[model samples]
Target: MTTEKLFPVNGVELCAETFGDPGDPAVLLIHGGTASMLWWDAAFCAKLAGYGRYVIRYDQRDTGRSTTYPVGEPPYAMSDLATDAVGLLDALGVERAHVVAQSMSGGIGLIIGVDHAPRVASLTFVSTSPGGDDLPPPAGGLPHISTPDWGDPTAVEEYVVRSIEAESAGVFDEEAARALVRADMARAANYEAVMTNHYSMNFDEPKGGSFGELTMPVLVVHGDQDPYFPPAHAEALQDAVPDGRLVLIKGAGHGIPEPLWDEFLAALAEHTESS
Candidate 1:
């Protein structure tokens, strides 16, 4: 995309970035829980653009530079989040686009595929499960990290520590990752607390039946080292979604690390093309 802007949709303004030419086929990239579009990373977006795609990534509400619900619960359901994505496309004058949603955001993509199929060309889920709010937890409980208050000097360090624990082999650049998280935190309000709510928020049962009903192509990407939603979750989704395929990244975790970025990028490009 040639420009980045704050586009209003669904009663709020979303901070969106575009790469490559608009006339090219569009691919909307939705980041994971509590993450801004920055998680998609500049290099990653450029690579997708090199594939001749108009890649659009945005900061979802309550994260990044987008609208925030600083107090209490957000006044929306999981499906409403999906509606926001469709509304964004409508605002941007995009008739249809492929969707690559990661983690909890993928739940929104699933809803869009079911409820707003005409707006989506294909669906790709990364590190997520179709089970939505009710997926089983891993054997080990989530690590207990003391998240510092938002904007505290120690906040960046906290972010890095948690990330190091999540990435399979700690292959990422520590200083760069810290800087990114720090910037994202400043753009957000009450970042850590807000994310806690986002992750734990309950959802009503999904309206559609199993994912097998979706007619469009689907792809499931999971990291073998992902401790959050394991490889089995990806396999299950692949089996459930009709005409779906799965790819497992050998050294990746729930988060995309530098080492697996190339493989992930290539696989995603191929998946979108075939779809």
Candidate 2:
């Protein structure tokens, strides 16, 4: 993978990994809540590259190798995160690219696609819901195993290890699971700003105007058994966007990097190509 260094809107330095030729069509991938760019698995990235597209994945601010916020006030907002995405593209001299996002990052990508239309060739939302007063939070609260204090390294590491072991028992390959767990641990060590950003985005009421402004093709992918954002949430988002399609993956849950990787990549490729 090729690496590029970027400075975002808030002056946070970030690292982005690139696959495929630079001249190929580009797809920018935004990962879900508490996840770094490494959440996008190597297999999926390779598949996209094999499709002859330039795939770019970055650690959002406060995650992975990106710069983190100091101990003072948090600069966390959906708008700020969305702006960082655009700024990354600008820094890379990319005029336009298809945007693919999962979980909380879906909202960020939507904001960018609607507000900065020219910069987005298409929008793909995976395992996410559009934010609004009517939207429901995750049912039964989040899984105990999934919840971790963003500021606590020990808790985060323990959470990662437990989550991976629990979720990947007989499903995910052992090596892949271990790598993902390690990546999650690394991300959690620097997660204060990203978690703050997530909370800020969650509590803020959706204006409801930005989504309708999206003219590019939109694709929503959700697992049939997703515990976090249920399938209904994906349906709601599909109804909200003018041009949206929903694809449901059976026997899959909230996470997309493992069992649903192939389906996710296929849907992404189809959407990007059609758009």
Candidate 3:
């Protein structure tokens, strides 16, 4: 069974869930921007736990049941988010954990891997890139990421579905996407804050140290068909890190598709166990 709790970390209450035995190696799963822990679906966590890993997924501030701020006025920066991830491990009494991060949270993982190196056992970055001017640009611009109406859940859900369609390279599942969006909408303290606050975060400074500085076991997972941060980004990231390995998921885009979970899980298990 999954155990859910609210942890007070970095001066905020973060809703977190854990699976499997605590004594097992811990894997911290960080979702993308404007996403809650729900993005790392429960079934997926259970499957990872089945591999004898202590899996952890949490709702970051301004997402799901965590803390919220006034819309269009966030008081924190990307560095704060990175700090929160480390603080969470402190609260959980986990000395070190294998960090599995998706999309925007990959930067957070990079920060932890570099700045708070002692707290991370390994890093598995998914659907993200190491920021560099020379890397190839995305296939196209991201969809205009604005939720039209917070009061209308249907409208918000439709926007999410459309956004996924724009970003995904695999087949789109309209029914599943709407269901997930509705649950997020129903559980959020402020849905508008969840969707818009991330954009307003202060990113004035760079995130983490250089990719070459990461000393831990590093795995780069990317979709060959990713529109945002194409496959080349993954190659560049892998090449930058010493002894880094890359797993290119065929037919996947910016997100991990349900049909490809096993492939991801297998790679993740081997990486964490070896680390």
Q: For each of the candidates, give the backbone clash count.
A: 3, 0, 0
* Candidate 2 per-residue C-alpha lDDT over 133-229 given as tens digits, one digit per residue, 9 for 90 to 100: 6776665644476667756776765666666544332354557666676665655445555444455443332243567778998998887767666
55-122, model 1: which lDDT tens digit per residue?
99998877877788744577777777788899999988899989999988878888888888888889
Model 3 — TM-score against the truth?
Answer: 0.94
RMSD of 3: 2.0
- Cα lDDT listed for each candidate: 0.78, 0.74, 0.87
After superposition, the stretches of candidate 1 with alpha carbons farther than 4 Å from their true spots are 132-136, 139-142, 156-161, 167-169, 200-202
Colliding residue pairs in candidate 3: none
Using lDDT as the measure, which candidate wins?
3
Q: After superposition, how far is residue 221 of candidate 2 from its true place, in Å?
A: 0.6
**Model with the higher TM-score, candidate 1 or 3:** 3
Q: How accurate is candidate 2 locally (lDDT)?
A: 0.74
Model 3: worst 10 consecutive residues (lDDT sum): 202-211
188: Cα error in model 3, Å: 0.7
